[model samples]
Target: MSWMSVDIGENRWLSVSYYCLRQGVSSGFRMRNWELQGCNDGLSWQMLCKHERDLSFGEQAHGVAGWAVENATAYRHFRILQTGKNSDAVHTGVLACAGIELYGALTLACCGRCAALVEIDGRALGSAAMLEGARAGEGVRGCSRALRRSGGGTRAAAEKALEAKGRREQREREVR
Candidate 1:
């Protein structure tokens, strides 16, 4: 019985999720177990799920899908372990991975943890910075249909927000 382990991390820190798709029968062997591991400092590694059944199992697999980790202080990195049966068997593991996104509760004054423009009365609120947006108490950030004044007309704030977004989009394109 032979086993293979592949590291999913590089130099910089990253958090990624991967799903394993069985390509074909192990010719003369069979896969037994698999697991997921997480490492913060890289040196100290911890296994989240151990020897669990192949979660992302599929018949015909395309390929592995993965993404680099972001602002997560927790775990970051995972891989699949396919236990080979015999030395003569030809077993293949196709991995597909993507970044796991966790969402939290949203508040009326804020856009929660997600990156979205704050809006009220059809007005668009600007983000505080790259990773943050208008706080709950920082007036209105953006305008939505619900945030329009009692007259049910587009507010100046909303127009400003929209224009700002358009300019930002244009700037992004130019940068690219």
Candidate 2:
């Protein structure tokens, strides 16, 4: 059986709470007796669900076949393998797929991996480069809001940060 796989990546991999798929445009290319599989190492596959020979997709070209996936583990890779041939007179595993969609939220590992800027009682955290106002601890790298004062509102703070970013870029260009 032939198969195709997609890598969601470890940084923001999906948990696949639910999934929907559409069949190919042509009736002869719709999926028949196909299996949806998942994998972590990409070599060894684990079957999540098996779909029997169904003609619903062939009936409606743009028809959608959806399933509620109940999986505890979030995989980095997902694959669909053609297990059996269709009702075509000259049977061949040359079917086509319109599209496949996997819906899920980001895992815990992806959280707290991005920079955040917050303010409390006029004191801002994550912007130690705001020397014009007041800075204390270390600043966050690649923080767009890393150079703003409290006197200025959020818009003014963003403008100030942009100005600082431009100056840093200019310095980098000069060094190059």
Tens-place lDDT digits, model 1, residues 1-176: 23234442332233332233333333222233544455645456455444434323233333222222232333434444443232223433432222223121111223343344444444433343311322222344332221112211124444555556667779999999
Q: Where does model 2 exceed 4 Å of error? A: 108-113, 117-176
The candidate scoring highest on lDDT is 2
Taking the tens digit of each residue's C-alpha lDDT, what string does model 2 give over 95-162?
56778887654332322323444443344433324322333222223333322222323345444554
Compute the lDDT for candidate 2. Answer: 0.60
TM, every model: 0.31, 0.59
Which residue window of length 10 is worst by lDDT in model 2? 131-140
The Cα error of candidate 2 at residue 169, in Å, is 30
lDDT of each: 0.35, 0.60
